[model samples]
Target chain A: MFPSRFDLVVAQTVAEAVEAKVDAGEGGRFLAGGQSLIPMMKMRVAFPETLIDINRIAGLDAIERSNGHLQVGALVRHADVVASDATFGAVAAAAPWVADPLVRNRGTMCGSVAHCDPEGDWNSVLLATGAEVIAQGPSGERSISIADFVDGAFTSTLGEDELVVGLRIPVPSGRSGGAYLKLERKIGDYATVAVASHLELDDSGAIAAAGLALTSVNPINTKVADAEALLVGQQPSEELFAEAAELAAAAAEPRDDVRGTAAWKRQVVRTYTKRGLAAAAQQAEGS
Target chain B: MEVNITINGSEHASDVEPRTLLVDHIRRTVGLTGTHVGCDTTSCGACTVLMDGTPVKACTVLAAQADGSEVTTVEGLKGADGLHPIQSAFTDDHGLQCGFCTPGMMLVGASLIAENPDPSDDEVRWAISGNLCRCTGYINIVKAIQTAAARVAESSNGS
Candidate 1:
């Protein structure tokens, strides 16, 4: 399979990449790992007239903790995330589950977040971790919350000329834990249904901060705000988790598909949320 | 666009279209047919090759993207000392039946041993999870990698 003919611009810097995107207009795309975009191009699902290859751009592959966030650059591959000591919570848990070893070697976290596929794991992990996408355009850079950055399935709030330079996931100052649970048919397959859970326990052993997000259960990566709200100010218990899990199931807008019936998927979401939260709270307690 | 890549220790530079996949470039341009293309999609690792010593699906990588990198296909696995240890283990253990996915399996296995000289059974299984083998049931494939790892380790200790 071959993609349609397009001009390739190898950019040396972030400014050059943004400039190329502006020149290429709406038909242009910034090629990072090309794991998803290249396959789409081969299937003729996407026909970009120009491709701004940002692989050569230096300083866009850093994985470091700065200020109060774990900063992942646009070129930080999934494998890098798995290998990094700095990664924690859902980010580390979901890194090995993205595609496979080969795909993970090249695919970037920023690109996955930008792609915003409902089945994609990184976005849900980012959403649960309260990550931010750093967008760079002709007007300069600005940080957008993961909730606002993901506009829809396979869509984002990024402007045509704007490039996602990196993603910043907030670091938990207190005792916190995160976990990503994905149910896939086989290795490298898209998730049948996945859940990302985060928890931070207060000094009183109650939930101080909580985040819950679902994948492949809605048109977009859905964050269960109501469920998260239920978790906060509550003690860790099976009954408390069960109530929050029910709320997560309620928030799911799944459709019947070949993977499984909508009801079955929602059930899995409920079960996974409970299990994920328990595991997260266990980690938090250990921390 | 012109891409200059070193395959199997040989430098082969060519002019290719931006859409040209690295697998197509290796088989057609460089005439190295050892790397098979089972599924054009990234699902199957039949087109797996070592790009800068890291295994990646060749069909999904643009030839232009691998412009200045060193790629190692199945042909390159043979060291100065005859066949690679993994290749010898595969033949000895009957790791392949149809031999279609052999090239990809061997490359990934070799890569695994390179990074981890002594891998667990689960580690071997996880490493080759990307490559599919309808034959041999993956039992012998896993055994072959383990055997090769032991052989490599023994030789290093003896030396």
Candidate 2:
């Protein structure tokens, strides 16, 4: 039912994909997994004159570790992340909770982040993991922290001519634990509200560092630094969790939509925040 | 645009519009209708197929995007003598009532079994979570996979 005309060009490399997009000019889009782009195209929300298929690009589907960081290629599928023994403990624990297995198999990690959907499951996790996004343009490659990479809802600092090449996640040190919790209205719908928490403990088993991010409650996934601050140096306790949850809820300015009301979202944020922090605390204890 | 893709281990070249979805290309040009399109959006896994050995929703993938890639549809699951073990298990275990979601279920199931020959009920559930089924309530589908896994293990041991 959607009508549009476009040329398809399969690019075998990142340079070729970029060149194709530049040559196509203002009306070109890169086709990765097409999990997000194709549906948007069918809905007529996004119409591009040319589609540069980047699936055949080599080295874009690998996941490896280097320099105390985990590097995931832009084209790595969510399923790949979920299945990998190296990254699966973190990614698998969260991936199956995404839309579904089919989408996970085709949806690329970079595509999800680049799409910058406010309710995306992985965005906040990426932020909580202290990941960096690598983008390649005509000039060269430049890396930006996830916090600086995403600007707002459905938007990023990425230039039109630039494409995301890969993501770099700093390896967690010491005793650290991370977890993602999302509240969805249905099985396949976007998260109405989500929380990602990372806690690192010192040798004394006291909280040394904490990272927390909330999604679907605002125009962008935001880290609740104040809440993280509330946990540092404190033992993981119900009272501390309640305090962090309260602070996190205060930080979020949720919207009222068909899925939920602002008040309900606030309640959920508070509830999920506590739960997520508690889980992160337990994970940190094990680490 | 003219795109060539290998479907079920055979390469087929066709002249298709850039807008043609891989699902449509397989159903129309390649004459394989086992893959069904359940939803316009990629939310449903009714059109699930193995693209380069990964189970993906064919509806979301454009035919042009699938160029030079190998795809496996449900119709390709059969062996020389009979149906694939999973297919026979689905039949013997009464995995389908309406059978609309059967192809996608089988494709996703085959992909799962291929990866993990012995999958737990939860693993099977997780594997086919993307493929939705209104009939059979997924109980028998899970049973079918369990049966297939046992059969596959038995055959492998026998051989």
> Which portions of model 2 miss their true places by more than 4 Å?
A1-3, A88-92
- Per-residue CA lDDT of model 1 for A1-287, tens digit only, reads 78888999989999999999999998999999999999999999999999999999999999999998899999999989989999888888888899988899888889989999999998889889888999999999999999999989999999888999999899999999999999999999999999999999999889999999999999999999999888999999999999999999999988898889999999999999999999999999999
lDDT of 2 at A38: 92
Q: How far is candidate 1 from the true structure (C-alpha RMSD, Å)?
A: 0.8
lDDT of 2 by residue, A1-287 (tens): 33277888889889999989889888999889888899889888899999888988998998888887878898998878876766622344566677788888788989998999988888788877778999999888999899998899999999888999999887666877777888886677888898888888888888888888988988899888888888889888999999999998998899899988999999999998888888888877876
Chain B TM-scores per candidate, in order, are 0.98, 0.96
Chain A only: TM-score per candidate: 0.99, 0.95
Docking class of 1: high
Worst 10 residues of 2 chain A by lDDT: A85-94
Chain A TM value for model 2: 0.95
Candidate 1 stretches greater than 4 Å from native:
none
**Deviation in angstroms for B112 in model 2?**
1.7
TM-score of 1: 0.99
